[model samples]
Target chain A: MTMRLVRTELVDSREILPGQWLQSFLAPELSSGSRAGQFVHARTGDLSGLVLRRPFSINTADPATGVITIHFRTIGRGTEWFTRLRPGDTVEMLGPLGRPFEVDPRSRHLLLIAGGLGMAGVRSLADEAINHGRQVTLLFGAASARDVYPSSLLPDEVEYVIATDDGSVGHKGFVTELVPDYEGWADQAFACGPAPMLAALARIAEGRRERLGVAKLGRKRGVGKPDVVGSTAARRKAFLQVSMEQNMGCAVGACLGCVIMGTNGVPQRVCREGPVFAAEEVAWESGW
Target chain B: MSPADLSVDLGRGLVLPNPILVASGTFGYGIEYGDVVEVDRLGGICCKGTTLQPRIGNITPRVTETPGGMLNSIGLQNPGVDAVVAKYAGTWAGWKTPVIVNVAGESVEDYVEVVQRLEGVSGVAGIELNISCPNVGRGGLQFAIDAGAAGEVTAAVRRATDLPLLVKLSPNVGDVRPIARAIADAGADALTAINTLSGIALAPSRRKPLLGNIYGGLSGPAIKPVALRIVYEVSQVVDIPVVAIGGVTELADVLDFLAVGAVAVQVGTAIFADPTLPVRLVDELTDECERRGIASYAELVGTALPPKPGAPSSKGVEYRP
Candidate 1:
């Protein structure tokens, strides 16, 4: 669905994890229309010195309550400002901005990988996949055990896996190490994380097509033209899709601040062409 | 209300249906607003800066919030002149409002080349030279800084295209009179002042600069005083119509610009906070004129300027310095 600006009221704000916050807003326009992978550009009170509105991924949207939750860390003044909002205060929001993840209907098994605070970008997709009756396995990576996303917040059906760099929690080393074991079983993979991790994931996904020997579906052994670069159908058929991040402005494709280099030799707008892109479409090693 | 009364003749026979034009960089080729804002209602649009070749722009964190304003160092991130005209000219050709292409470059040749390409384009109505880009680190000479370069580039581009030309003035310069005089002497039809004031913001941790580019252009209500001072200074120096752009948040700010000899005003950074402000200002301006019993907005122009010494004018002293 196309993006629209909506006004929402702060319903609840809580500290779900250390230095991380989860605030719920009662907004119907966003709750009913927002899909997995969509985000909201929220305007903070201008009473303080803050002038620009902040963008956040919709962590969870409850259609019944008309409430949507956003998860974020207090890394700067903008995020810190959000934590002080009262329950009844109103905020102007522009959303569900940007293109969303396109999940193939035929895919039964979905793998979601998130690193550190990147979980917010992929968290909603888990809710969506489970509601669509797809089997989901989530691999979350953090610096330590305390930084991990709480399992109680996730749907009971999702198979959750945790990895910590310090060996203070579930599995030691990076979360990408767990993907190979499930690579053969899963039909599609989606990830949101640090640039280094996303880059690593993109490389692994590029080789999976050859290693799995998975037959290219519905092509009839290559007949017609290739799927248009950066199209939704192209992203759905790809084995890996990533949600990219950048400092944003306008959040509606007006400001070209948030952009990623594309394989088509053009800078694709992350706010328009994607915050979600097929792995191959990105120039991962160009050091943008 | 008569729509005919709203029409304005901006010298050289160029007329506009209204006076509410979107400033460059903020509007993004005039299509970014989509359905949120009615482009047809706007009088004109100054698109983002276009150069001879594509610019990747500065690094990440291009924009940040400051006190009563915002700082940006976008560094003219455009898809080059040819790509820009090819991508949006057709869409603009279909719109009722005119798209004034704002061109910026490193040299005179760059400006001429870009303007030459836009000369016969269907959607392009005019040209606005961005002579005040202050974020670039090296070899980026601010055109509005010196009278000689400003006059040279303005004359060169004036010769390159028949499109109406408007040269933007930088506020960072010590004295704007010489530069404004040179640009007008070089054949510019109008002038826009002032671009953002040079400024920087500290990171929240207070350890470093907030913007990735370290320095950024300060824009918003915070810079209104500085912009007003420059507009007042440049408008008196040049006979060409002045198009004032600064922290125009309300009708009072608009009136203040007009009082200082600005024939028209372009609303910039303020749009991010209030997108409806420009349209509102249009209505407010009409009401203000009506309330004052003035037949046209022209009566409000230059009311604050001192009387010219040689020319017997009743207005306020031309600053001799």
Candidate 2:
């Protein structure tokens, strides 16, 4: 798809949590064509010190209203600058970029997992899955009840589950602890979070097939043919797919600034090859 | 007064329609930005660094933002010389803007071999030697640190191809004049001063270094002063033109570089914040020249340099340094 640099006007901005923000922009070009897991590289207003545009997952996109939203926490100058933007202020955005999450067509049950601000990464997928008449279970984890995503913002159709580190919330443990309850019920799983958490879930996903004793379908047709790591076909067939994060420069795969170690001993560009990848395709313990 | 001529020529058949170029490593191969930028309007595009073999580059956390700049340790990741010539040469040949390939190598022979492969490539207008890539393990900063090595590499590549050669200088040196002179005497058409200063940052946890390579080249406004000083020092010793690079985000930065004897300026880290900046600077520079009623931008060059020997040194070099 042709990526355009559009001048998007901020239509709404609000403080969703203590330090978290949710901003909406009137970007018809981005909202119309962007999928669930794609993101936009937004240019900040102050050019003096901040030299790189911030990459934000498209948290939500409404083509009917021509509005796209981004959810973020004010952790640094770039995020702080975004919070200061008022409605009517125009910001330049380069997007509908990076590969989007590929959901298997026949998968009727989809399990989504998100940690903290990573909710922004998988939030849109919930909406997209429901629109396709698939059942979605979103397992969200946060630091405490105060930092948990407000259920009022999600669609009424989703089965929202929460796990907080502190016992003040739903499940008093890591979100990966809540996966086993839904592994058997889910046909496919997608996640985005801290590396350790994703790695933990990946380990669990490895043993899931044997634990559930699920028959490997279509194995004979693909015998002797190794799946190409990071390929769309590989990600589609894997039980777990994850969205990865890195310190980025161009966000269009030019600078080679955001790369992660791949299983094949080659470095993968997060902005080009993925922000999405099959759990098996990444070399988790490579310490890259 | 027709939009003040901004074109510049860095000898040996290389002429930029304007003086603003997108720096190497930052602009990719000129196709990554898609329609976001008007590629044809740019003065030039220095595509990502190329080598004899495809390099995977460094590990994760290759970039980080500092107070007024950023540090990057990309290690010159590229698809190799042959792949580059095959993939982008045809596309670049169709554009009005010149595409200068930035070549990096692990050794002097590596640099010459890469240049030889690019000698007759259709889209290549010139060659920019990345002799000061601070991210690599070897051969990058080695060539730029010593005068003999810098000149030797420049001369080797000069013999390999007839392409206009621009050798990039490193800011890590204590004195840059000798290296600058050696490279110019070696037949380099121009010089690009300065490459990023070596620096490092701590991870958020403070457990270890932030960048995977442990060290990164710092660029942006933080290095502008250092760049201006090097350009001033190098331009005085070398007869060839100087193309200044380091944290150029606006017209004032461009003018500052030119005043210090830089014939052209390159926008590097700033492109990440605004991909359209290089093209915008070209327009703004023309306006600045017109506002000053200058016939061409060349009149603005070396305007702030110390007067010649017979004349008094207004504000002397020591004061600026």
Candidate 3:
């Protein structure tokens, strides 16, 4: 409901990797209320044929500075137009859209994962977790070293770990490979990446309790009252929550354009129910 | 500059404060925009396409951006009409603006039943019969492609509800004049021309179509000229007012639609880029009327249109729907 149309001025723009660009915008209205995993629907130059606004994860929001950053690769004309903006250039952005990653108050050690451009989806959570005095371990993956998100951009408190397909980084495999090592250590896991990567993590998060041999202490809280499927409480308690991606139209849920198959046999709007959802809420193999 | 009268009467008691409306499917229920849009400021709010039964919509990847437009195959996803009335009708009734519920169905009876349910609903200001939806497997393109079916459904809905009726035309047919005339004669108060044109985009793999529904209704600036042509042709043939829609991005586009014989205009795909556009367009149109030394926006309507009835033009096919 706090979603709004805010005029954002480009503060700075830079290419952090080979093709990935990170641009910062000063939007007090959006930055103050935004949560990690939530996104903004940005309008491009209207003169061109780009009819749909581009949706970007609120890569990072600095309420103190009234600045928000969006990280993306110049994949199409929309992004190409964004990169052309100068420092004083202003654009309209509809934001703080979609639901953000629901981190539990009880969680202390958080595990973050990102694949390629998916890093933009979860990068902000690290800053948030550290601000809450939570320990964070970030596992990142990309096709090559040149594509890795720069470590200089991350908070120093984060235990940054990287994986490259060509083995030019810390771990030479998919970031999911690094998850098991920290599985028992992390109280909760949050990820943003390709569908396959999230699916793999979902498979891993399923048996975590058994793998760690953690027993229910006593009347496992709220034993009879179930967490309503897509509620914030349900997502907050989920072991692994992922920020999803799909081709989006009206990021405001009206268009029903960006949807993913839900395990409950209904298609859920990625813009409404989520750009983020609990791992189990999604029908991982439904081929959505 | 003196204030130009921006009000529009769509006939049978559906009078709007202005000539700008947010197109169906784009504006949701008019509540989705929250504080971003001032709902009461616009001419009207056309709610999403509603069916007799709740629709789950199509598979994923329902939309994609095209050259100057976007392709959407949302398949008319909406809660059943009853749920729509139960949930959003009260809120709509409270707002000063009229909320027209857009009805779509597989059968004429289905359209009639939906209209009957909304006949006296407090928030339901008008019924826009959507026979032109191209995304659904059946029913949609069927009623729109032929003149008889379009008339049959419009007449049935007309008998069902006393509320104002507007039939949205499809651009998929070879010719649309006959169909427009048929709907007008069948008692629709006005015509909203044209609905999205059917089109397809290939996936990046180049092996398959990009949209899950395969073919999507093409909307946005790319289809403006086609919309203008239909509005031009249909306005010439029908006595009812033509509510123009399709890629209206600015005040200029609004004027263009008006000159082509559209009494009012709906901003559809452009809303995705600028949520405040329709309201802003209302202001711009008012200013335009003031600047043109006109007392009403109606004076600008049909300015670019050629002389009426059976007049031969260098352009256009002779065939009629």
Candidate 4:
């Protein structure tokens, strides 16, 4: 994909949660081509101290309005700098980077799960799925009700469900606990969250085919070969895909800073090969 | 007034078009930012560290940002020397900027082998020996810490290839003067001082180390002073031209390195924040030279070093504790 350096102006910024923010930028270049699960590396104004651009998942991209939103928590100075930005302020962004989620053409039902800020990763997919007339179900987990991503921010067609660890919201438990109810109905699943939660989802996804007694169904006559691991084709065929994270630098894959251990024992760049990957492609047991 | 000349000569017929260069690891093979940066405008591009074998690099969480800088444990992840030549050498051959292959290995033979493979290859202008990678388990920091090992490795590589060789110095050492002297004596064309300083960061949870590798090399504004100190000390001792690299963010930092005896500077960590910084610095340096009314940037080099001592301090022993 062709990545561009766009000068985006801050269109709006609001604290969506206690510490998290959902800010929108008017970047026509990004909104036109960026897909769900892709990300942007936004530069900070204060360059003296923070020498690295922060990587954020494209929470939503509205081509009609030329606006793309990024959701992030103020965990450090970079995010804090973003918080002080005014509406007219302009920032440089390099994106529509990394591989995006690959949906199967025949799939009619899409299940998306996110943990805390991970909502930012999968939020856009819901809109894209709904726009395509595919049924979308979103399962979100947070520390409590106060941290839950507001339903008003999501598309109206999405079937939203919530799980809170402290029992302050719907379905008092980890979001992974709710996957069993939807796994049989969903044709494909996508997730982004804490590694443990994603790992747990991966474990459940592995048993889904057997538990439901469903055979691998979509290969055409005489064209039934396994797609290579880590390829986009492989991800489209898998039952579960996940967006991954790592401390990053030079998000364009130049710096080997943002990498995760792949099942092939090679370190995959979270900023390049992913931000999204099929469940089986990743070596979840590798504690990296 | 005529424009100031920023050309730098590192001997053996190798000359940089200007004094600004993008450091090895930060720029990848130099094509990663093709759309964003004008790569041909820079003085030189030191491609990512090439090794004898394809390296997968470190585990996850390889990089993290600190207060004023960032720490990285990339562990010299590369596609091996053969693959590098086969993949990017053709592309680099078409660029105006000279591409220096930064070579690293677990042993002297490994370094020599990588350099040998790069020797006489089209598009490869020089070799920047990366003897200071601290993330690896062995042979990386070993050659850089001791003067003898440093000299031996340099000498071995020197005998292996005739390309202009630049050995990178590690700032993690106690004293850099002897090591710099040893590398120079081993017939290195020039010296690049200094590599990243070894450091560590803890995860937010504090349950384990932040980086997959327990230790990472810290780079950026935070290590500028330390890098300057090493460049100052090493430049005074070595006869070869010193190309400084540390926290070079702007033209001022480039001038600071030159004032401290560095003939040229390589922008490393700053490229992460702004990919076009090195090219901008080149323009800024020319403007700075014009403002100072200097015809060449060489006039600005080594303006801050202490006057050479006349006959080795006679009272040196009297001050010993």
Pairs of colliding residues, candidate 4: none
lDDT string for model 4 (B76-140, tens) is: 88889999999999999998899999998878778889889999999999999998743244534
Candidate 3 residues lying further than 4 Å off, grouped into runs, are A213-219, B133-141, B309-321
DockQ of 4: 0.73
Runs in model 2 with CA error above 4 Å? A213-220, A224-230, B1-3, B133-141, B310-321
Which candidate ranks first by DockQ, i.e. highest?
A: 3
Better of 3 and 4 by DockQ: 3
Candidate 4 segments exceeding 4 Å error: A215-218, A221-226, B133-141, B307-321
* Worst-scoring 10-residue span by lDDT in model 1 chain B: B1-10
lDDT of 3 by residue, B176-263 (tens): 9999989999999999998999999999899999998899999999999999888989998888889999889999999999998898
Candidate 2 is graded, for docking, as medium
Recovery fraction of native interface contacts for candidate 1: 0.45
For model 4, residues A154-260, the per-residue Cα lDDT tens digits are 88889999999999989999999999999999999999999999999999999988999876545555457666666888888888999998888999889989888
- Candidate 1 CAPRI-style tier: acceptable
The TM-score that candidate 1 achieves is: 0.91
Model 1, span A1-288: residue lDDT tens:
556557799989999999999899999889889888889888877533665678899888889999999999998778888999989999888788878888988889999999988899999999999999999999999999999999998999999999999989999999999889999989999999998999999999888879988865445477577676669877887789999898776777766767777887666778778889989899997666
Predicted complexes: DockQ each: 0.48, 0.74, 0.79, 0.73
Q: Model 1 over residues B1-93: C-alpha lDDT tens digits?
A: 332245555666556666668899888988886776778877688999999899978765777777778888887888899999999999999
Interface RMSD of each: 2.1, 1.1, 1.0, 1.0
